[model samples]
Target chain A: MSDPTVVPWPRPVSAARPESVLTVDDILVRFQTRDASVTAVDRMTFDVRHGEFISVIGPSGCGKSTLFNVIGGLITPTSGLVTVAGEPIRGPHPAIGMVFQEESTFPWRTVLDNVAFPLEVRGVSRRVRLEKARDVVAMVGLTGFEGHYPSELSGGMRQRVSIARTLASEPKILLMDEPFAALDEQTRLLLGDKVLQIQQTLKQTTLLITHSITEAVQLSDRVVVMSYRPGRLKRIVDIDLPHPRTSEIMTSDAFGHYVAEIWGDLRDEASRGMAEAEASRGART
Target chain B: MSISRADHAPALVGAATLLGLFALLELAIRAGLVDRYVVPPPSDVVASFARIVTEEDIPHRFAQTALEGLGAAVLIALVGIPAGLLLYRHMVLRVAVQSWVAALAAAPLVLAYPLFLVIFGRSAMTIVMMGFISGVAPVTLKTLEGLSATRRVLIDVGRSLKLTPAQQFRLVLLPAAVPTIFVGLRLGLVFALINIVGLEFLINFGGLGQLINELAERYDLAGTYAAIAFVVLVSVLFFLALERTERWLRPGR
Candidate 1:
């Protein structure tokens, strides 16, 4: 699989416009530390098309999260620009919803209420918000668990609530950041299947950040691989898979080839990341 | 666990301890191991409980203290919590005043009671004001802490959802900060009551503290002990009320 033939992946659907739905144009982000300034994303550029599922995969600390933050408009890049559907990314837009990696379900709220929060913030009435939220909860396979508190749910269920909450807002794009990283492998795959089903049904543009090769290949239409921090886009590998996917698809030789291909691009950078981390630790000691 | 054991264990342990201690004290005094007039036996204190209630007018005194404490508790909640939120909103204000507020919380604030007396006169106003001042620092500081300690990821979620700043506070920050704020309120309520009772004793004008002072002066040891026990009772009641409020506020937690 070291030099698997680069099969031309099909663009599942074309954007209505030429510029794409979301554009990251030469984005650069730098942090000023106590000792020195450090670059996180070095002039990164990408475009997520309408109704496309794009994944950013890299080693830990490879600025995948930083780029993700920049895309979500939580952090302003040092330079360059990001535009969603021809509008420049100013800050968080109502049209772009995000699912966080951490437990984002409000502990004080029941699952129904937690899912309804975004709509409530948007001033939607109780009857409408709950009705919409219930639909999304069902979409994530959490129908009967609506009245339960976040603490009552398992780790996987809580994440489902987070996803449902984000989806209830009816955003034009979904931004996810390692949403299943905390869950066990079995749950991750199951939830990944659920997410793929949701994406297929919604056909909403999505940009996901993950280190999971299987997840990126199984769920995403295109995977943007990044190098070690000061992250630069190393490659954009397309996963030429069919629609409405499941974890069972991973058993396919083509899926394995795609996974192995991503690992091939990621291996050296991952070890380089590890070496840098170790060197930093040694310096600190 | 059996139903009887599970249901009755907590109530029984406290009751059993009190009865055992009462018996021990009664035995010690009868055996001449302790003084009768100076350190009253459990029997003497129980005997005085009736007189302390009927003759000494414990209800009126209890009401006076409760009223002052209630007023101070209200003031602490009204002023302190908002002030804490303000402190949290302004990082410079927090850095400038957090240490001073913490030091004031730990201070023997009763030492500053003379100023309160001069300002509010030798009335219940003096005691209530003292209680307010004593309680405010802890409540404010704790509220600041609770608000400041909001999880970054939660805030990011709120922001990414396009929530306005006020909406973020209401839907996200407020709920997250509540458990810690409840803890602060508990501390503030207890602190306020201590200062209120102490002020009452100092002024000799109102409440159970005055009754304790008068009893002690007349060498009514049993009466004094009984009066002090009432203060303990009030504290327990305040604690239970706070617990109930916290549970109601964060239901099913």
Candidate 2:
């Protein structure tokens, strides 16, 4: 079978970096309900070295999203800290960009305006923002869609617009929350390759949250597996694979071995989490 | 399936049905199957309509009612939309005022006319106040609902961009709130019309409703019917105007 997720562009080489771009240090998050406080993330710690692409894989409700929210400074951790470029993440910082699972291009804005939103907010001149937005849109292969609204575009196209919007800001770290989970499997693979190609070109530090083991293996230099709710770190596996990774890598022996290892670690935690959730529902009834 | 001429078939049928009803009413009166004194025949009604258009004080009454309604709509849009936005931004205030707002929305503004009359005393002010009271609640409620209904993902995207509070409100919240706010404005316009006409009738104020009352009291049944038809035509025209305005404002429509 032909490889589905291969892009035509040549991957750019990265320079050696000594320091970490992002660090999550022993973070804990708790949500207060009327009846009781629920822990979402507990004592989780991780780091992404400069120019590295990391994937986080866990079952649904494993607090991976909460971790992303904390890292992006949308929500504060009840305890512990996160720092980007050695600065404590006090709140939403300009250095980190985010793409959500749901494609959220503004319905009222044309693709170009949507992409240029961050620059417009920062008081950049209209001419400068438009020029930068056009470059990003072209990079995402959406040059002809500049004047189209989000509603006029397909799901895959809309997500591409969102990626362009994120890139227009030129942030060092890109945090994605299951950004392809909503797309069809084929579109997911194609966009996944496009994203990898973009990352190779820009060398931005990226953290991706996903549930698919294959996706984690395909994209990451390292994959961090987390346990179920009140989620704790389970294991971190280094792919140590060659750069400009391709779909052919998925069929390799080393890739199969890592997938099996991660599955073994996750299987019991997945069942336990499911049973706990069901029990909680039953108790409510 | 491509939408073409077939898509407009329903609207064409509806318009034809309305025209048929008018014809049937006119024929029934002409055939003396219905009393002309009670239901003035369509020809006589049309003639009366022409007379009102050419000679009667109908134009002045229409202008008066329209001015009051437009003024009230502006006031409601200004006060209610902002109040709703403020409530959306402040959780404690929302919780505190939600029930009160609901009660105000549900209460009949017509019943408050006596109170307004005491304050403003049976003038254009009284009519405008009635319209304002009737119009404000829906705009406020709809604006609040729209603001709250903005998707979390969009807000997350805005946060990631490090947008200031004002920037977020302008870029994300305002556009998100627009369609719902337009719904509110549409509802408010209807309410304003209803209240303005009701106040004119109740207080003997100078508007189309007052003209209807005067003609009815003088036993000029044709004139009264003509005045009522005029009111209906104005309302239909107003709604069409609003529909066009909404389509113009909606991006990519």
Candidate 3:
């Protein structure tokens, strides 16, 4: 099969440094309900090195989002510490930026304005921000369409705009919550290539929350698998794929091996997740 | 971006249907198929427009009604929009006052013109106040609804950016609520105009409504119909201006 996800442009070579940029130490998140207190994340400990791409894969109810939120400082952990470059995160940290799963591009803003939003909020000068916005917009291959509104862009393009917006602030880490979960398989693969290229270009440290086996193996330096809720660390599988990765590598034997290994780790947890989901739904009715 | 012929179809059809109805009324009256006293010939009504302008001083009356309607609209936007924001800001205030605002929208507030006249004392203030009360509800309710209806994800996006509370409201919340707020504004204007004209007719104070009452009392059917036409004209003009403003604010919509 031909690979459309591979862009024609040359990718700059950059290696991940051994120094840890983000550390989540024994993080726990618990939600209290009228009936019972639910533990969402339990003792999830991990460290992301500078310029590493990490994908956390799990079953649907595996609390990947809970962990993602905790790391982003959106949810205060019931206990444990989250630190960025040794500094603790009490709230939304300046060192981290996030992309949401849902459609998040401001409808009122054009492509340039949407990308410039973070800078604008930081009180960056209009001329400087727009110039920086133009550069990021070009980086995302959305040049010549800066004036187009979110409503005018395709789903993939809007997600690209979201990515550009986050990158504008030059955060130390990027946290994405299934940013391509809403797109189809083909678009997902294409966007994965785009994201891979951008990450390589900027040498950005990224943590992706996703359920896709192919995506986990295709983009990650390491895949962290989680068990179903009460989510916990299952295993961390290092992807042995080559650098400057593309969807073309998806057919390789190493990539297939990683997919199967991660799938093995997830299958039992996925079944458990489904059973609990059914039980809770039945109780609701 | 290009306007096609099909895009204009509904408007063209509407204009044609109205002209056809007017022509039918004109023919029926002239052919003696209908009572000329009750339903004046369309031709006579059209001719009476010039007479009313010359004799009845229609310009001043039109201006009075326009001014009252403008006053009500200004109050609706200024007081009504801020009231909505305040209500949205305070959950306690919103829960306490939301249902009453909804009830106010449904109430026949024009009937309370006498109460307004007593308070503001038999002047333009009375008419404007009546209109303002009648019109304010939709603006308040719609504003509340619009703010409440903003997607949670958008707010999360703003929060993730670490935006201050004021910046979040001004940047994310207000702009997202705008299209729906404009819906309320348009509806509120319609209600305000109706109450303004209705009160004018009731109090025999000024504007097309008072002119309609005077022409009817004089037993001039053509003049009454002519005055009614001007009232319709005012409503149409108001709607057009509002739509223009809305389009300018949200061009993507």
Highest lDDT, which number? 3
Query: Which of the numbered candidates is closest to the native, going by highest DockQ?
Result: 2
DockQ-based CAPRI category assigned to the predicted complex of candidate 1 = medium
Between 1 and 2, whose lDDT is larger?
1
**CA deviation > 4 Å runs, candidate 2:** A1-17, B1-11, B31-34
User: lDDT of each model, Cα atoms only?
Assistant: 0.88, 0.86, 0.90
State the RMSD for candidate 2. 3.7
- Model 3 pairs whose backbones collide: none
Q: What is the TM-score of chain A in candidate 1?
A: 0.93
Q: Chain A only: list TM-scores of all candidates.
A: 0.93, 0.92, 0.93
Model 3, A98-123: lDDT tens per residue? 99899899988999999999999999
User: Model 1 chain A — which ten-residue stretch has the worst lDDT?
Assistant: A3-12
Q: Give the DockQ-based CAPRI class for model 3.
A: medium
After superposition, the stretches of candidate 1 with alpha carbons farther than 4 Å from their true spots are: A1-19, B1-8
Give a tens-digit lDDT track for model 1, residues A1-285.
Answer: 532222233533645443488988999999999999999999888899887899999999989888888888999999999998879988887778898888888888899998998888878999999999999899999999989998899999999999999999888899999999999999999999988878877877888999999999999989999999889989999788865578999999999999999999999999999999999999999
Error of 1 at B144 (Å): 1.4
What TM-score results for chain B in every one of the models? 0.93, 0.89, 0.93
lDDT of each residue in A150-245, candidate 2, tens digit only: 999999999999888988999899989898888998888888888888888887789999998988988998999999988899999987666677
lDDT over C-alpha atoms for residue A240 of model 1: 83
Clash-forming residue pairs, model 2: none
What is candidate 1's CA lDDT for residue B247? 76
TM-score of 2: 0.91
